[model samples]
Target: MPATAPSASSAALPTLLRLRDETFDPANPGAYNLYLLASPGRLCLAVADVERRKFVALEEYQLTTGGVPALAEQHDFLSLRGWNAVRLAVTGRAFTLLPSPLFRAGDELAALRLHHTPTPTETVRHTTHPGLELVNVFAADAALADWLTATYGATGRMLHHTSALLAGIVNQRGAASPRRLYLNPGPQELTLVVLGQHLEYCNVFACTTAEDVVYYTILVMQELGLDPEQDEVTVWGELMPDSAVFSLLRTYIRNVRFGFRPGNVQYSYRLNDVFEYRYFDLLSLHFA
Candidate 1:
């Protein structure tokens, strides 16, 4: 049974941007895998038909504010629009990792509860990545979780944005820099992940300007002992070619370059006109 997409006449919100392949078919929902990414004030989604090896549609919505309430609203909107079985990757900054050996199922919330000073209103949840041998603990608003459970029966697979980003980066096999730094920038946040023989550092920073981007990138490099002139800095996410952030990064980092979509997955020609680096996390969910 194929799922159906909402009609184009569906009510419109304050969308930041929306792109769709001409071949996108609401009648052939079974042909695509849907991926949804929610951040503090933004939501990015992509639908890829792996059987056909192409992306059918993608959207980036700008929320007035991001948090539990915002996520609930966006999630509901998608659900009402007939999108189902959503794989949610949260981009909020409330995640911590634990080794698999140290993780226990009943106490996922307690494992990293101290790390996140969740208010009485928030709830903590945990997801384990056996492949990475790491446990991810994150927080969501209690009300949001309840609403989702009541609305959809349960919160299907939920992943931290960090997990999605790292999975996307590790899944890229071609450009293996022994000691490389990968950045995924968003509205007011920049996620930095360092990779070597193993994962070195992963953290997010709050920034909204070109200078802040450069400052944080260089600061992390210095602390990690990566040379601006020597090591590679690969970036992905929502910046334009002529954008201030891209321009500043190139000026300071010698080996910097934009990242491409994961090599393992096949992209349809519908995505030929779209830049490879954009919607990285959303598209990478095919592997996630």
Candidate 2:
């Protein structure tokens, strides 16, 4: 759809969460980095002060419908540019990671084909993590990729959500940290990542019940020879400490805890009310 004014529904897009620091200046977009997270169910925008390394703004919209083309039409800031930098993280399970030594730029489709069937309207995108010596190859919505190009052009790049999650794992994991599991729970789905010195396993699970999430967590742990009674599991996103998912997760595993915001960056006092562990993927976009 061509760019146009926000519709009545678009203007009222439920703002699930919104925080703007006292220092944030919408007029001075050129001074900050804008990070956008787009998925079928959620759309998020975060702004970081490049000079201070502080996150000055955050806006999350819970979407019952819509896609990339709706983004600029729904939010004026996205249509405007002059951002110091921008990176949009596309969320989906149609992604895979290969070691740098085995990956080639032109082979994204073939690599992703093993795990996901890319649709005709999707475009292949890759982000190489030199520190981890791995390349994440994933498929992004073709319209979303094209829209980013038309709006930001050379000013931005696209990344897979796993890239940000992995970046968070690496940045937060200590040198002496034991083999640990990370769970990022989302609406009707769960993502599990295991870290053993290096990334050992990562996968997304389609789930509907609390039982499904806990069952898969334990199964993956046992399959990987991780003892549920002794191993550590950290969780972030979509669940409260009192939620059924967390309750059941604790029953199966001994070491269970929530995640925290990235320690490297400062945040507005306004964001303190938000759960620390929430939006790990969005906050970690800075690391990706």
TM-score of every candidate relative to the true structure? 0.84, 0.93
- How badly does each model clash, as a count of residue pairs? 2, 0
Q: On residues 1-288, what C-alpha lDDT tens digit does candidate 2 reach at each position?
A: 222233354567677777777777767888889998887777888899999999888888876545656756676577777889898998778889899999987999899999988889889989999878999999988888888989997988899888988898888878888888899987677889998778899888888999999999999998999988888889998898899999999998999999998778888787887899998888898898
lDDT of 1 at 113: 70
TM-score of 2: 0.93
lDDT of 1 by residue, 1-288 (tens): 112243444335556656666776655555566677877667677777657767677776766654434544544235433344456677777888887898888776676576677889877887766667878888876765664555445424567778777778777843555878998898788999888867788888889899999999999999999999999999999899899999999999999999998776666555676789988888777666
The lowest-lDDT stretch of 10 consecutive residues in candidate 2 is 1-10
Cα lDDT, model 2, residue 263: 71
